[model samples]
Target: MSGEERGKRAARNEDLFRQVNERLHDLAVISGSSEPHGKFVCECEQTSCSLLVELSAGEYGAVRANDTRFLVFPEPWHTSPEVEAVVERHDRYWVVEKRGTAGAEAEDLAERGSNLL
Candidate 1:
């Protein structure tokens, strides 16, 4: 293909990647048992309800979000009284928020992982 065509193809690929990312963010991680990490299953406040998605270290173990984009503010940030108040009220969230790079790594690990655990 011509150089112009190649550049256009790369641009198209970037655009496609962005679109796919947008769609991925739209999804909620399903909650269940934490086998490899731990035996206990996460029981967010919504357990009594129909929601099954757990509070995982999404985005490692800093700010948490559940099945519906419902967010959990993990530590460091959790040090703040505001975050602490939420935790005190909810009393279910275990893990605290991780740093940005770690969060991205956790996401990658989850993507590479399986449910066999």
Candidate 2:
């Protein structure tokens, strides 16, 4: 795949992971506890990556403020230059933004809750 294709794929994968976390958040809210922090799957480009990252509800909300920003483990193995840019690094995770066409697509999916490609 070309760099552009890889970037789009990465964005789609991360969005899917984010949806799963959002569902969990909704469930927590319904249950009344609504835990402030929880472990969520790393919203990275690598589909095989099963690593989980911890985030507070506020931190997650901050990431959701921009559809391109994703939470990824701050490890060397998680790097993907063609797909995303590491915008911020925290103790447990790094904030990555999808680039190029991928970013546009991610923003679209975030708004529509559906896939375009």
Clashes of each: 12, 0
TM-score of decoy 2: 0.87
Which candidate number would show the highest TM-score if scored against the true structure?
2
What are the lDDT figures for the candidates, one per model? 0.30, 0.81
Q: Where does candidate 1 stray beyond 4 Å?
A: 1-89, 114-117
For candidate 1, lDDT tens digit of each residue in 1-117? 764444333333322332333333334223443433211222222223222222333421233232111232232332222111232223333332222333333344335432322
- What alpha-carbon RMSD in Å does predicted model 2 have with respect to the real structure? 2.4
Cα RMSD of all models vs. native, in order, equals 15.9, 2.4
Give the clash count for model 2.
0
Q: Which pairs of residues have clashing backbones in candidate 2?
A: none
Worst 10 residues of 1 by lDDT: 38-47
